[model samples]
Target: MPTGNTVSDGVGAFQSREQIILKDKKQLDCENAQDDDNDGHYKATHPTSYMDTMLHLFRGNIGSGLLAMGDAFRNGGIIFAPIMTAVLGVICVHAQHILLNCSEEMYRETKRPKPPGFADTVSLVFAHGPVKLRFLAPTMRAVVNAFLCITQLGFCCIYIVFIANNVKMIADQYGITIDLSIHMIFVIIPVLISCMIRNLKFLTPLSMIANVMMAVGVGVVLYEAAQDLPSIQERTFLASWQQLPLYFGTAIYAFEGIGLVLPLKNEMRKPELFQKPLGVLNVGMAVVGCIFISMGFLGYLKWGEDVAGSMTLNLPRGQILSSVVQALIALAMLFTYPLQFYVPMSITWPGLRKRFGPKALVAKELGYRAIMVMLTFVLAQSIPELGLFISIVGAVSSTTLALMFPPIIQLVHEGHRNRLTKYIVIKDCLILLLGALVFTTGTYESLSAIIKFFRKES
Candidate 1:
């Protein structure tokens, strides 16, 4: 989930035809596993149970992004961070519901036994949507997939930056003087091999290891952050207006797991159980939100304005426990690298198939993998700010994908059915505006900070 391409794959170490989403698995896995039955409906050979779906939902939504909650609180202040996080959490969950409902509506309308992936749903919604929007189906699909590529690759960039930042901090503890950029360059070794990994099956074990490491790492981080904390009055309840958007970007990126919802629900043994008042998605997200709120509150209370991009990096230096957490988190990101890389690689690689010709998929993919992996490393080296980098991706891409699109799709779908209500328009419009605001302000502040930092660093 932390490494989620939201593509949510490869040949040699770098090629997969499989569509493995960070919902933990690709929607294609479930779809491809089922055969067309006599009733014309598709069913999974081994569908996931309610609890299973809940676990997937939890794993998919929360990951490295949660690690930044402390920094986000630094930006938003204490009281407002939790309050706004709760509000945004509810909106994010509602967006997921909107996406799921739209996809199900498409299935019922078209009588398609198979449930569509997120991008497919966008295309189909447009195709069957209002007359003006029907012509935009292909365009919409490409747009959705394009953002998927951007977001997933963006996640990869953040991973590289995060790994480099923490590892460099640990290296500093031992009087090691390797520059941050050098650490990122060294990352090229394993990331290339991992990205070249051709099979999703192989990544499963690596991903499991990452999950375990992250669990331990996050637990250690939270435990340490909660200790020797300052009084509530020490930190502002509301931060400066300019910094609030960074908080929005951070929180949205952490919560925007809407991409995982449809894919998870589609593969469930009882899909209806997914959208109930007490559904898997709701309960899981609720718990994750509480964790995020707690982490932000505690981390900020502990470190105040000085918290690092990741709380793990803020642990007291020279302690074995602190160093262990840093190492675990770094290793966790490394293992998950391949899964995130394959997402955008899968989406864009197909478009280049004709250029490379059919016979060259393997060689072509090998070259492509090298280029994409390097690109992520390059981007990370350039920006080199973990918390701000995460905010930029969340602002520019995640917000659009998670917030902007759902409302638009809902409007189009509802309009297609002649059920478009004024309240619906008003509600969704407000959400879209909120997303736009975050995108604009967050992008401005993050980019400005990076530029200023580069001027000083260089």
Candidate 2:
């Protein structure tokens, strides 16, 4: 008696609650499972109930990436930030809708349920053939995974670096000179503990903690900004507009996590309920964005160009509350890092294991983990700057993932005939171009800054 079942639809088979839970954990393993059907869909051992599915969707879209928004606005300007963000949001939503439609179409056409994993399900629909080394399809897939892997890993590193640097910055206020190595150790120890844990389920509570931290941090910062605004000089709105382009990229980056849940549709108990999570996730992201935009606007309005990565510095130095705000933001980013690394790592794993060997092989797992950790350490060392790292992550990676891939996938998946498809393709391409411009501009600016610093040192 599920609501959607019509008279014309055959009565569906029902299962007991015990059947769903699977008493024997080893028997419920993913690798041992039979394929759902001949058309490439594989049944999941533990289907995520519709409610959990929705939560996962939202969680996938909310992460530490939002830390970049202020810096993006700093460079792109206020006008550009909001405009691009609205545009990008619409495009991503449309692409996600199209992807869902494609999934439904494939289900009907093939009469086979979709696979458990997101990427695998999508590949069944639009994947060309075996990606031989010389084949274009394989090459494109490789490039996409490579870009995704590098971006996520880099963002993950930035999270640790941001936390450590913020810690250092706060300590400086009290004249505490903590050595850089000790600061890094503090950041790494927590991350290492989290990373070494095997199960994704174990991290769910941590995810909730991170989300609450974001909400509270944004709340505290905005409250502080509003109270302080009265004493600060009123600035012209035109100046905010003039600097808009530099910051728009940052705001868009805040919402970059919105669509990452698309690939997991098949695992949902009620596949149709996927949209609920998508909605929840966006609502959460929008709330965060509002807090960031308001705080960034007020902070910039008050402090002008002196505003650095952490807006807490802009508040009166003696304000203990502002210091607490700074610490919370860093902690939130620390919580966000695991999720960021996790996404790309998920994608990278299948490809890497195929290239290397079986997943049971410890060497492969250890090697990949070591590489990821080492790269994070290197970025933390070289940059030693938090906001700058955020800008780099948002400008480079978020641009490609958020703006570029959605439209490209739509064009390829939904062919040109559909009006909605055509509209999305056009609209997303323009937004993608805007993102590309931000990427190029941000890269150039960072390079210029690095060059200037080196020249001065010499």
Candidate 3:
């Protein structure tokens, strides 16, 4: 009887263990199915087509910076401006390629999802890199995030100055005197409301409207500029060599779309097509470079050292059409403020959320954005030098984000196996050197110019 009881107990235990295993398996399967559904929902709602990706790239790059290209040409002159534009274009494209290649290789090796942004890429590189460097991965991620936040905020500051200057110019033309700071204040509420939006995909309609306004504004400005083209013989082919640093700052600022590249790629309906030969990036950047070159060359040729900080500002004040263009461009940038602010908010909000907890997330986020807008408004009021501010930010933040990080990440990812040829390594080193040079020199030049301007104003 005892032997029979022992057999029966063993059988009951085995059956219980099997039941537990089956329950666990079902739970796991359900969780996986839920994850798959979430991913599918995301793709369904946010999938961007090839052309849409191209448009987003263009929209991001060809902002207020494009209007400043003519001023950039004033520093580099005709010959150097076009040449440097092309060179920078190629360098920007190559740097993007390096980033994408490294991302793909890392994804393959780790069998993980590729990084989705510039900061994420930096963190991934350091995390999966040499054993010694793995410890610094979190710090490096913070650094990249800091740079991105600063860059986007810098953009906000520039937009404020841009809007203020243009609006003040129009107000003055009508014999209405209002401080630029007041104009800056006028747009704050609108910008703050726009920043309340949490999802980037939802901003697509606003982006499209802004793009149209910008296109129309550019057309009007170009038409106005072309009507009074100065003699080619009269214009200088080369500028003072000392001014080259300023040119580097401005042109680099114009092409600083590297931050947007990966995000655009990650959101695409068919991401693989983004990296193909003659793909979205290449085509989009090519068009962007052409637009910059043409605008700078033609505007400078027409104005011949008389162009203002923005091409729109240089438009005839007496013309109603010029006023209309200014307003349109201002509106375009007004809409773009949120798009630019999105990166900084995404980076900074998580920390804020952690501190405040999930229950108050929306309130905290909106409050944070409002504070950011007010801060930018105050800075714009203080400095009020749109061109100089743009150059300084581009030199300090854009150079690091666009030119410095990519090659370093590539080297780290490739390791010591010399997977990259010696020639490639040498080339990357050269690029790094160039970035460092631009950052140091351009920063100094921009700061000096700003200080002098402020002193004069005082």
Candidate 4:
């Protein structure tokens, strides 16, 4: 049976023997500790510097999901796309800050290590100090973890699928028919790589690869935009009213993964030194947004919405350039899968640690890794693929996590003072309402699209 820290021996079968002893000591000490409010000594070890933390957070934010930007741009339109994306970025930044502040407060007041659920922990902190959380605490906490789980797991699958699709893209350039089984290879390859490693440090180079590709990819798009400058008046002014929505929607997708940056502050060695990761988030998101939209606006101007997967594929078919772009894009996808997987893994870590002994934890972790591989396998094999499912998930969950959570967290942290409450609460209510509307509408549209496609198939 699982105790507070010491899990069953069978659980640690895959963990190294040393790991078993260390984890046992850690768990035993934690469980036996008397201070419920003091989170103990974990925070003191290995604090990351602010700049390093920011870099890590920035990469973590985008993960693999930005690959879907071209597809979202295919649907939302160019004019409103950047604007909406900026708005979402602002909301995400504010919400993330609020979550962190609440997390810090909970640590201070409750003396609890960060609560298990993001929202729950915040609500508990708020509820403790004269805020009548009565029902909202548990509701918000459940919402946070549930949606977070879906987003994390779904993102992992999304990246794996992208990897498979990217590999197929490469195969096509070589005059080979890509195997349908290529999808399974992507899943298995990454899972094996990630599972064998002991720390995330091994994946840092991959993160750098992702950052470089994102930068180069954006630069290429901006270059394309420069080429279209002469026709900008015509394209910008006279682009059809009908095309606008598609452009904007797609641009929003480019900016969707901003939430991945949140945990860095607490994880950092000197979280206080960096001010907050918000500045990094804002700058990174802006750079990413501009490059993505410019690519879409220019690529759409040059190649139109029919561009699949990435705008890079539409580059003039020169052997060296085409092969390089495809390889880079594939590497970007490979880098992305782990970044996305890390989020869920963080959430899953506690459960895995408790259920299995440290020694066997490696195998259980691999088992979890296997589950993600299976999910990717299923998604890739499903005929008549769809792009909007990612958006639907993003719009719905991100909306709640981004737009609603911030103000709610703030309200919890600082008790409701009627005068200030009226203004802030009302504004947040509207923001939340708008987010809900967009998410619901987007979900309905995606579902309808799926149904229509399946009906035709039938």
Instruction: Output the better candidate (2/4) by lDDT.
Output: 2
Off by over 4 Å in 2: 1-63, 78-80, 106-112, 115-135, 179-182, 230-248, 263-292, 312-318, 349-364, 416-425, 453-458
lDDT for each residue of candidate 3 in 1-458, tens digit (9 for 90 to 100):
00000000111111211111111212423432322233332132366788877766665666777888888888889888899889988998899888877766654554443233465567777888888888887787788778766777788888878877888888899998987778888878688788888876676567567667878998888788788676888877888866788888888888876766665675678878888988888888899789889988988888878877689999987889889999998877777677666656766776677788878778777888889888888887877887687778778988887789998988787764357778778988999999999999999998889889989988
Error of 1 at 262 (Å): 0.9
> So what's the TM-score on candidate 2?
0.73
Please give, for residues 179-227, the per-residue lDDT of candidate 4 as tens digits: 7466557456756576445465565566556667755654554464356
Cα lDDT of all candidates, in order?
0.79, 0.52, 0.73, 0.50
| TM-score for each candidate, following the candidate numbering | 0.93, 0.73, 0.87, 0.75
Residue-wise lDDT of candidate 1 within 1-458, one digit each (tens)? 23332212111112111332222124443544346567655566567889887777667766777888898898998999999999999998899889889888876777664767688788889998777778999888889888877888888898888888888889999999898999998877889988888766678777777777888998999898878877899998999988998898888888867777776776778888889999888888899789889998998999998888888888899998899899998988888778777677677776687688888689888888899998988898888888888888888888998889999999988987889999999999999999999999989988887788889987
- What is the per-residue lDDT of model 2 for residues 50-149, given as tens digits with 9 covering 90 to 100? 5564454444443444434445545544454455556556565555555566546645554443321223324433453233322353344445555555
lDDT at residue 70 of model 1 (Cα atoms) = 90
Indicate the residue-level lDDT of 373 in model 4: 58
